[model samples]
Target chain A: MVCIMKFDNEKCGYCGACTSVCPNSSLELTENKLIIETDKCDDCKRCSIVCPLGAFLEVEGN
Target chain B: MKYDVIVVGGRIGGSVSSLFASKNDLDVLMIEKQPEIGVPLQCAEATSEETFQTIGIKPSNRYICSEIHGAELHSPDGNHFRMYPHNDEIGYILDRKVFDKSIAIQSAKAGTDIMVKTTVKDLIIREGKVKGVIAKHLGRTMEIEADLVIAADGVGSNVARMAGIDTLFGTKDIGSCVQYKMVGMDVDPNLMQIYFGNEIAPGGYVWIFPNEDGVTNVGVGIRNHKKTAYHYLNKFLSNFEATPVEMNIGGVPLSGTVDKTYTDGLLVVGDAAGHVDPLTGGGIHLTVICAKIAGEVAAEAIKGEDISAEFLKRYEERWNDKVGNVIKKSLKYRKVLDKLNDKELNALAKFMKGRDLDSITSASLLGLVKESPSLVRHLKDII
Candidate 1:
């Protein structure tokens, strides 16, 4: 299964809100970007729920 | 470069710790990952007058956008009450871009060195002790050594985690927040408005704090929910006629203070340490208090020539002695609050809407909880 979490950089405020709520600790916020550890994420959509900007979305994985 | 103390993240916690540490005669160096000292604001910027008093500076109008008089709280069913000040000053809405930088300036003026755009990529540990940091700036990586390290690195808290501390926040214990700095918002410029309901914010609340005339900071914070904070924020905004000037977003640790804020040669403060009120999700004041303690404790540890975990534990002890119980009590209260549904909240608000805000106490609040057996069970755990 592929990582189902999709990120839209344009909508990201880079505020680290998604990083704080990532239950799996799979999200990282570097100074310039928010990085996702897709393999570690369970596709829980916690990021989608907490993201204020809808930057994270769910997609069917190949 | 070597220093007596290295403070990571140059916001309130880092700057305050550096300020006090430098004043105590420590060679302090503060490193911020941002190119600017304060940019891309994440906070709602409402803080008390005590915050300024703690830092020994007058609250300047340059940074203070509006002086608040009191707060107005609204329940889902439209029942509301006002929280008036009992001889104490209310608070101020700050221009955080200016406010955060001013504090960093104060810390620098006190003889602390600062490097902006420098990120602490890793920590240098020797014999189970943190000795320094591996930092990156402009694609250049360098190692800076220090005797003691204070991690005020906000919610991401990579520095503290690198030093073997678990700064990760649970979904339930953290709040996902999104705020918009808005204009043409017709809110009372002197009152902070707070709305609560499960559908509105789930475990958190929404705020419409007036910044200046015709401008407001409208935001929403929700916890352990499937809906995004932005969705709720937009839903709330539909009730008002306002235009967004900028949108700010971040995570808040409402899990009470983190366990073990101190470990060999390293001390954690601010959001990284979970120095925020569990009930209100307010952190600036608590961060100010704990950061100062972290700084003073760091100075003492350096002077005592003991940078070990045992010595650094004093940082934890001192801060806990100051505001630890508040966080603990707030956590308990938050637990009880989280158990309350919209119906219970509406019922509680109905009973208190016309009562004197100053007359309400925990005992009286407990009496109100008696109306709902579900919350009473949780309330007993706190009482």
Candidate 2:
């Protein structure tokens, strides 16, 4: 089992604070969307903790 | 290649560290993940002249975009006060990209090997001692050994965590920031402006800094707010008839220094160590100052053949001695300011209306609380 981070486009402000605070460099914000490289993510939940808009969600996966 | 020191992140802090280490005749290597240094600048680019003097670097025309003479602070109720430096120039608005590159160039000139487009994957820790780094350069993974590793990697520091140091910053401790380089603006070229109002920026403030090229950097920062900094920045920009040339967004760790900045063979400098001021959110000056100390100490450790945490404690001790009290006071002040409502903020501003910048010290704040006993509740910790 593994955990993944998800970005909510509707709620995300795209300020890139989540990306800057992500310890693994797992997140990037483009012009229209927030991209998460699942392979690079260690599921530390830092992005979720730091997102001011509560845009990041944690999901368990196989 | 093995090096006496490995400096990560290649920004002002990393570059300064590399420069100082290499100048002391140590084998230093600086690594940056960016293809080019300082692209997509993340700062409002306002710094004081004293910063350059303290860093022992002369002001260069290549990056000095504007020289500001003074600043104006606008309170929540629209009451404003201006403060000027006793000297001619108060600060400078920088072309951050050029300024950052200049630091990198100086590092190279000081005999430091620089590698760009390189990403540090993890630390090569042996038996709980950091020995080197696992990095990817040009799509190739490699292990680079070093006597000491300096993590100057901004707010989100992978190196610090990889070295078993806690680098977590709570939402309240971090300031979410967004800014735009706007042209065609009608702003005072020599006067920077700061606006403080909960309606404008809930837990933070808005700043308008002008450049010599007729452009202005307009931005806002807030902590743990429902509305993001982008929301506030957009609202602020709407009032100006200006076109945005560039947009920058990032987080600033405003919690002062981390609990620990050094371990065996490792030192965390700059924003990675949370050296930014809690109230103002400025890190460049602190970064340079701390990085210089880190460099000097790392070089001495290498020469002494002692890269233990015991030896590295000098770096922390020296930096704490230099700015620890100031950061402590600023954090206390921020706590007091955060608890005030708009009415209280306005009243405090009114009380401080005729005071100059120097009078904004802790003593004046305590004096204000004395005059208005109602403020005692909020300012008790600060006083």
Candidate 3:
């Protein structure tokens, strides 16, 4: 099972804080927003802490 | 036993006051309650770059984090307002711990003695004039004597209270905030995001500020009516996979200046002065601005040996003139924002869509007010 990733685009500051901490490279900042590459996310939870806006969240459990 | 000026609290406002007082060749003593100068931080640490210019204080590499060009405001109903950079008016979110300590260091360098872990218990008044303070330090009680006392203490200031000033802040006038400092995340290092809504932060907003390295400062502060600043952050983060590195909880005053910030032989600055931005809960800039004024006034009062209420009134007048109008205006704006519901917020967002906004030239936030004219109906009451 894969947890669905949610991104509040408005809360994303495009700081790239999520991408750099994501061990799976699932998070990427593109054009001032955090985009989740669904296949790359391992539900590591790294993206959430580094995300300053609380913009990203996990909707489901794997 | 005697000093020209004594500043209570070692936060931004207190530090600023101490720095200026010492620089002017006055004898100064700065006291911090905590063992460390800036521990258990209480502020969001965001300030406008324009403020730094007025004080001629450059951002040191230690605490200076990311420089933000503009801000994005998000409504709970999937609405957003983004402001872009145009003028030289960029804002910066700082490393608050470092920023605060630097103020103390600067003050010390200017010849002020900073005492840490010194808790002030009460004010020492003589002849109906504020004289000094009684404090406890290192398992011993001591009295610090000074000609004038300046409360650089936080919102619930003991110094102000001890001076017979009403330090009680109504629930409607305060903002409760909770934040996290995460180290493993990455961000643009330039842009900031703010979220608003009943579910997220009622009468207040959530924010994400990115700094240098990989640290990101994320948090929320709702008006006094709302009590879920922490829960909202958790709920909002539930959708994302992340681990907390550090958690911070605090409050910001959003109701404009306190009714009374000064009295005979005593003055208040920083959070104690209630100089925060009523619209957004940002106070560092305003507090420091007022601190500069407070320090100057305190020094002058001490030199003239006239710490009367009328003499100290100068600080209030000077600070009010500098940012009083803007803060007062923002407080009125806050009233409209607090009463807004989801549907109303969406309509306001729709009204602001596609409007060219320059940070300086345009009233970026007022666009929402135009959409909801009901906000204007109470303008007479608010302003």
Instruction: Output the number of the TM-score-best candidate.
Output: 1
Query: For every model shown, what is its TM-score relative to the native structure?
Result: 0.93, 0.88, 0.80
DockQ of 2: 0.26
Model 3 DockQ class = incorrect
Best by DockQ: 1
Model 2: runs farther than 4 Å from truth?
A: A1-5, A8-16, A19-62, B85-89, B357-373, B380-383
- By TM-score, how accurate is candidate 2? 0.88
Ranked candidates (lDDT, high to low): 1, 2, 3
Q: In angstroms, how far off is B20's CA in candidate 3?
A: 0.8
- Expressed as tens digits, the lDDT of each residue in B1-383 for candidate 3 is 88888899887888889888887778999988777777766666788876677566887778888888877777778888777756758788888888888878888989999888887877889998888899878768888898899997776565786787765555556676678876655556788888778888776788888877777788877654423466677877776555677877665667778778899889989777788889988888888889998888887887888899998999999999999998988887887777778767777666555654432233544654676666445443643
Supply candidate 2's per-residue lDDT for B73. 83
DockQ of each: 0.62, 0.26, 0.02
Indicate the worst ten consecutive residues by lDDT in candidate 1 chain B.
B374-383
Cα-based lDDT for every prediction: 0.86, 0.83, 0.74
TM-score of chain B of 2: 0.94
Q: Give TM-scores of chain A for all candidates.
A: 0.83, 0.77, 0.73
